[model samples]
Target: AISRWPNRVDQRELRQSEIYKQGMQTRRRVLGDTHVNAAEVQKSSFDAPFQELITEAAWGHVWSRHNWTLRERSIVTIALLAALGHLDEVAMHVRAARNTGATREDISEALLHTAIYAGVPAANSAIKVVKNVFAQLDASGE
Candidate 1:
């Protein structure tokens, strides 16, 4: 098979790259220290590569972009996750939305769009998740 690029970078080297470092910073900023610390504590050799991939690609390459504010990205991410029936991820992002400057109203509007574009069921489920997370946040005074 023909390859697009002959060279393949090693995972170890990629982890040490500047983008990875930037991604880690962005991830911690967005997800918060507690979430990142819990994830790190749960990481094992089995999922190390997957963890690095998201850190470098999703966080570094995409989230780090300056064109859109984190708030905007948070709205879009919550909608997409809701649309895809990823209720767990929707909850996680909903929690992260606070740090991204996305208000509860923004999330509600995004879910409305999700209901129209994705499906009623998906949006309903996401709404439940959002409510639960919001309750937790409120209880914690976060």
Candidate 2:
């Protein structure tokens, strides 16, 4: 099948676009320099396009929007990831929550809502992920 995305030249232009720059900033802010740096270090040609797509679309377009604060987006993202059984991402966002100013109470409350709406198993699994992440954070004194 024909690819629907732009050609390589256009994709190169997009990498230099203002939105991509904004996304990188927002991504680094939310995920932290350590995590973003590790991800960048691990980036390879195979997944480079995927990374850029998410950086531009998710971070730049949705996350960088002014309608909600970073905390709000962080909570929502955690809930959605949990709902979709994206437990690894749930853990990631839970760690990012600290940077977004989301407290443990806020995350607990969000998980409560996730339990009611997304189901018990999903929320339960996510809560476990959160606990592990929290333990790591506490140990690191972060």
Candidate 3:
């Protein structure tokens, strides 16, 4: 006969887990240190839980998947962000797309493809955001 086991965990230990560490690194790398730092600095009691959730769940589990290169992920992220009208996130991902080695032409094509399904207005606004991001990148010599 087998005995049932009780489930228990230490929350502090969970914070120091390897997966959390890896997710933090990936989040910083993809979103940039400045942006990540700002988010951390601005976190409040009300939002801290939500922040942790995304860091562990979105960055750690979803982004840490090895099925695609970061470049491909950036492209797909840009498309999804644009389609969903997450324009602010789109701007950030546009910068990340460049860092991930996705060319401007590739990004433009992705937006054009998004226009077909996500609607022209969304793509138009997204294109504007991308252009602004490109300008900033160029000015920074990135």
Best lDDT goes to which candidate?
Answer: 1
What shift in Å separates residue 123 of candidate 3 from its native position after superposition? 0.6
Error of 3 at 69 (Å): 0.6
Candidate 2 lDDT score relative to the true structure: 0.93
lDDT of 3 by residue, 1-105 (tens): 553544656454564567777788988888889889999999997897788888888889888889998888899899999999999999988887756778898
Q: Which residue segments of model 1 deviate by more than 4 Å?
A: 1-10, 13-15
lDDT of 3: 0.86
lDDT of 1: 0.95
Model 2: clashing residue pairs?
Answer: none
Worst 10 residues of 2 by lDDT: 6-15
Model 2 per-residue lDDT tens digits across residues 1-142: 8877646455555436799899999999999999999999999989989999899899999999999999999999999999999999999999999899989999999999999999999999999999999999899998
Please provide the root mean square deviation of candidate 1 (C-alpha atoms, Å): 3.6
Question: Which pairs clash in model 1?
Answer: none
- The lDDT-based order of candidates, best leading, equals 1, 2, 3
